[model samples]
Target: MLTVILYHVIFVIVVYTDTGPPYNAFPQKLNFYYFSLYVIPSTTCFFIVLLSTIFLVVKVRRNQRWRKGTSTQTAKTNDKEDKLVRTIIAISTIFIICSFPTVSIFITQIIHKQFRYRDPYLGTLLLLMFNIGGVFQAISSSVNIFFYYRMSSRFKKVFASLFACRRSGIQGTKPSD
Candidate 1:
């Protein structure tokens, strides 16, 4: 986590220095740096999450098979595990769907230098795509709460309590001694 924070800090510093005042346009020279820092790390993290989820699902299935004739307690535990695995898969799928546009833009930019926000013809389209991607990214970051609330009873209770109205006392008065 520290390394990830440090890596992003370095990226911010580099981009800030490269862009100078106003920072209207990114330095084309740093395209490779952007690709290496942002694209590669994000892609790697996505794949890692995907692969780990797959392994977890396989392990859970294997356990379920072995515990087929186990006690009711084990069955309940397996049901919880199944919900968790499903939640993870849903989250991973959302992440991939949301990130696709941004990743596609990055790779496209790298392959065709002419394809960017400055192009006279494609500039508007590219900007729109970028904005849509940003919206999707925001959704990806926030939508996990809904999944947890839906899939996990404990999460649902805790989440509800966070917003649940409470009556401290009648008419805002303190309780009688």
Candidate 2:
């Protein structure tokens, strides 16, 4: 899926960030460990979360696709459930959009020197923006479950049943494949 590809994209950017005549830390031995471990994993998580949100939203939207003569707009407007899904998608989209520039900026700066133009001030600023955006985005991810519950009845039912099992002290059995 695109989620996996996004991870690779960020990875490529990370590699690129170290290329050419640029900021040297990324290309240095000391930074190698942190770059390969923490930075890569965190960047992958960000892209995975983003792409998953997009996939869910697209699935919801696809369900409301217009038939030959039916009105897509009408369905969204008239149906409360679709409207709720639309809202969830909208909120998720906004969060993803707001964070993308920051994420990309940091990735670009890390992998490419052109973004910072070798200026320490610009480097500090990009890093600051990326860190701040990531913190806020983490909060947004945490709230996604509530939105899913409100927007998708299937999700709500599964969540309820899972909690119900815990309340009853019953270990839920997995279904046979």
Q: What are the root-mean-square deviations of the candidates from the true structure over C-alphas?
A: 4.1, 9.1
Candidate 1 lDDT, tens digit per residue, 120-157?
A: 98889889998999999999999988888899898888
- Per-candidate local distance difference test: 0.79, 0.65
Give the Å shift of residue 107 in candidate 1. 2.5
Query: Where's the lowest-lDDT run of ten residues in candidate 1?
Result: 162-171
Q: In model 2, which residue pairs have backbone atoms overlapping below 3 Å?
A: 16-111, 17-111, 17-112
Clash pairs (backbone) in predicted model 1:
none
lDDT of predicted model 2: 0.65
Residue runs of model 1 more than 4 Å from their true location after superposition: 18-28, 69-73, 165-177
Q: What count of clashes does model 2 give? A: 3
Worst 10 residues of 2 by lDDT: 25-34
Which candidate tops TM-score? 1
lDDT of 1 at 142: 99
lDDT of 1 at 44: 72
